[model samples]
Target: MRNFQKEALILSVRNTGENNRIVSYLTKDEGILTSVLYGGPKSKLRSLVSPFNSGTIYLYNDEAKHSSKITDFDVKKYHLSFRESLFKTWAATLAVEVVISTKCAGSPEECFVMLNGFLDGLDLLDENQGQTGLIRFLWRYIGLLGVQPDTTNCQRCHKPFYSGNFSQNTLQYKTGGVIYSHSENGFVCTDCYKASFDNPERLLFSEITSKSVVYLQATSMCEPSVSRNMKLSDDEIASLKGFLYSHIESSVGTKIKTLHSGIGIL
Candidate 1:
């Protein structure tokens, strides 16, 4: 058996056998890990299970050649701001859900840093700004996973997408993963779009308008502090948020409970 202590953020927790609970946490030292907390419900440790709470834990790793267990824990900081503000709570839950759903054990340090920075940003933002912060976090998360859509040049042809008075209605290849256009894969040239109109299955992505696509891609690469200054029209912001949320849901193949519960309200 091996024992160690580390600071971690509670990503999720669920009731187990009777009084026990299963906790999933992201630690600076260990990335993502799951452990069994004996007598969790009845013990004082119940407070540590809430999402967004940060704490120190004493873990016992049986080293069973496959998995490990956390027999005990101690709370450090619970971030009471989440309870005072409903949006903060929602944002925190969303952040936790995204990380929990996408992350595997032993991920890179960059993932941990991104998540930590997002949580800290949530703490600083007011309720009205939470949604934008959430969008930014999702964009960064997708980028970190290497699944972000290509908004640069044409996917079909290797041509740069210039910002002229281009047609607003362009189709994107669904399976290409990168590049945004109905006709080609990488960066479809105007000539290519004019050529291919016969094939089906190549659906159009009208959700991300040209203006919105430029902002989403640009904002994802910018510094976190400048996110609030990003000027997006209400329609553009709404479209970008919806597009990213749908993409994540489709990729994960599961509906996030927090997002589903507060759908009408958002």
Candidate 2:
């Protein structure tokens, strides 16, 4: 058995075996790890080991069984702001699941920074700006996983979504550049969306507007708090969320409970 301690974020937790709980953490040293938290629902650590909370965790690993148990968790922040509404809760849950699904695929430091920034930004965001804020966070998270769809050029038609300045503002709207297909495998230009219109094999394809392109470009490479938040209409939020969440589902190869649960709410 090996015992160790590290700074970690509580990504998720679930009750198990009546009293005990299973806790998932994004550790600064170990990336993403799941360990059993002994004791029942009434345990002292139960409250501390929660979604969106960051802290230091002490764990005991059993080498033969390849399993771990949490000895102690000292939380630094509870991130209670997101609990204010259903949408905010859904957005936070989405972030947690995305991080876990990707296994924090790059430098753990970079991934940790982006995740923290996103949660913080969401907490600070005004209610009116929730949609845009959520979009920015999701885009930033997707980029960290190294699977972000490139909107600058179409993978199928070999056409450029942008022109001179390499900015979303420079995208040529003419010749049908408004929409793009994010098939299960990869990206296809909006102009070519007709080619595979009836293929049921493709898991999902996003019809993103020029505004979405702009938003993606702006948030793709930066932390979530880079700029002031924007206000988007209900339809705009739904479309953007649908587009980004589909990319996540395709990449993770799993259903997203948080995204689907919202239904008409997200």
Candidate 1 CA-lDDT value: 0.65
Candidate 2 segments exceeding 4 Å error:
61-67, 154-177, 183-205, 222-233
Residue 246 local lDDT, model 2 = 75
Worst 10 residues of 2 by lDDT: 165-174
Q: Write the per-residue lDDT of candidate 2 for residues 22-101, one digit (tens) a residue.
A: 88888665678889998866778877888898878999999999989999888888778777777778878888877777
How far is 77's C-alpha from truth in model 2 (Å)? 0.9
lDDT of 1 by residue, 136-243 (tens): 888777777666767666565655444432234243323322224423222354455546556463465333455555555556655554446656667766777777
Give residue 43's lDDT in candidate 1 (0 to 100): 69
**Candidate 1 error regions (>4 Å):** 40-42, 64-77, 104-106, 156-203, 253-258
